[model samples]
Target: MQAEGRAPGVREVAAAAGVSRQTVSRVLNDHASIRPETRARVLAAMEELDFRPNRAARMLTTARSRTIGVLASSASSLFGPASSIDAVEDAAREVGYAVTVAHAASLEPFDLGAALDHLRAQAVEGVVVIAPQQRVQDAMAHLALTVPSVTLHGAGDAADEGVFVDQLRGARLATRHLLERGHRRIAHLAGPGDWSEARARREGFLAEMEAAGADAVVSREGDWTAASGAEIGAELVADASITAVFASNDQLALGVLHAARLAGRDVPGDLAVVGFDDIPEAAFFAPPLTTVRQEFAELGRRCVARLVALIEGGDLAFEEPVAPVLVVRESS
Candidate 1:
């Protein structure tokens, strides 16, 4: 066994296991031809000597950096994308890969092109695109990237291998929750039309309303911001018949909640409110918000896992959209 203080080399491990350094290297690299007994002996020797293969050296020799590129939205600091980034990093580390992030604040064609070029230059094995804007999807469609890539919150055309939370289902859940509470004249505060997630949510809400045979569906557009929610919420509150409102996301929901307070409407007793994305602050809202929760982290991990598998020439499967869960609380 090699001394504890001394870092063991390939040669030392090879000698201890009665195998050539080349054979040990091949085994460590997951080469299929090595005998089972030989591989086991080499692994045992490595354990005894506390030998750690130098990743940098191995990467240099194999021309495989074992690094993945993440093209996250510039607005990633916000709720959805930020949580996704964290999940991607966690999954990558668990699988023995490192992640490099690029913030493409704008989804313009030129910006996405430049971002892809930058990731290619970094020798990334795969890429996970985290932007879902129409412009971003258009930019991604134009890029001629040969590297394996997947997009989060993307439409079917974005990538054959990608993952997205079921925004439409979440919207339906929120609307259904409100309806079950006996709110007939419910309103929806939708996010911008350019975002795929927003569109999906809108579709879900409309579908649910149509199915329920509701008399009318009132809607207002928001920019997925607290201020937008507040502004639109005020309009919804102006109508005495509007007894419930569903905001597209938590920030906007918070704004709606504020607007409700400003309008002096008692929640649940006089009005019910539901939001999507169940962000951390949703629970702490003035009356504790009832919202739909999308597992942003799970979405990120799936994106990275699928892209990495594709990069490694492994099987890739398109999974159904992950379902959203409704968190019941005081607000609704």
Candidate 2:
């Protein structure tokens, strides 16, 4: 797929489809009078030339772009962000809206601001933010926002805005599962401090630990990577008092499992391990894994529905809360 030259415009699309410019325009705008055969021809031409209709140009007359822009902190390979993004796209398409994603080059404020500006330049009617960092949320509050927007997160709180997946409840569930198994001195392998999800999860863990009157073994700061977890776990092994672990994510739990093995500790015997975010491969991990599962698809759909409602001037307080489930497995 190499570029021939400048992108094909409406004229080129019309010529390729062997239709009049008016016919091509009608097809692009989804006019009620356009014939199905002609519309198919135009769509085929668009596919062949990789042509995309310019929403900004069309908005000149209708003042409606029928598009939503997404501002993500970064396009990380993490499953939670990736899955939620996919769900948002699917849900937006179902409601006849196109999605435009602008991912920050980094998690820095400068990159986030640049990504927001780029999305704004596209003239999107509304925007959805998928960045869950506290700093990003702070940045959003200061901006004199001119567009209706929604943000999806895992903070586990009912707010005046945003859709959350109840990270606190999930963390408590994970911690309780360990406690029920008669394990004491439970350890918490937390994620990055700046992330709202990480903070919420740690809060839940600490609360549960204190509630149970158990000594808390909080690990060092983690970056939500297996390598970081392994590094932290290596240190955690030296603590003979710690008997259970709840990692903020599955990857970290996997590292803890490895660390336990190296130290000749048996899972569910010497140490019970649990994780959050029941990723697909969790079931197949060496001894399986106990995890907390958030409804990412429902979270995504609700986010789009909320943002669209905001754009359409309908009910902005629908308040569809997404709950998390605890999946019990062998490791715990």
Candidate 1, backbone clash total: 0
Q: Which candidate leads the pack in TM-score?
A: 1
lDDT of each prediction vs. the true structure? 0.83, 0.85
Clashes of 2: 0
User: CA lDDT of 287 in candidate 1?
Assistant: 91
TM-score of each: 0.86, 0.82
What is the C-alpha RMSD, rounded to one decimal, of candidate 2?
4.4
Candidate 2 clashing pairs?
none
Instruction: Mark the regions of model 2 whose C-alpha exceeds 4 Å error after superposition.
Output: 1-61, 157-162, 318-320
lDDT accuracy of residue 166 in candidate 2: 81
Clashing residue pairs, backbone N/CA/C < 3 A, model 1? none
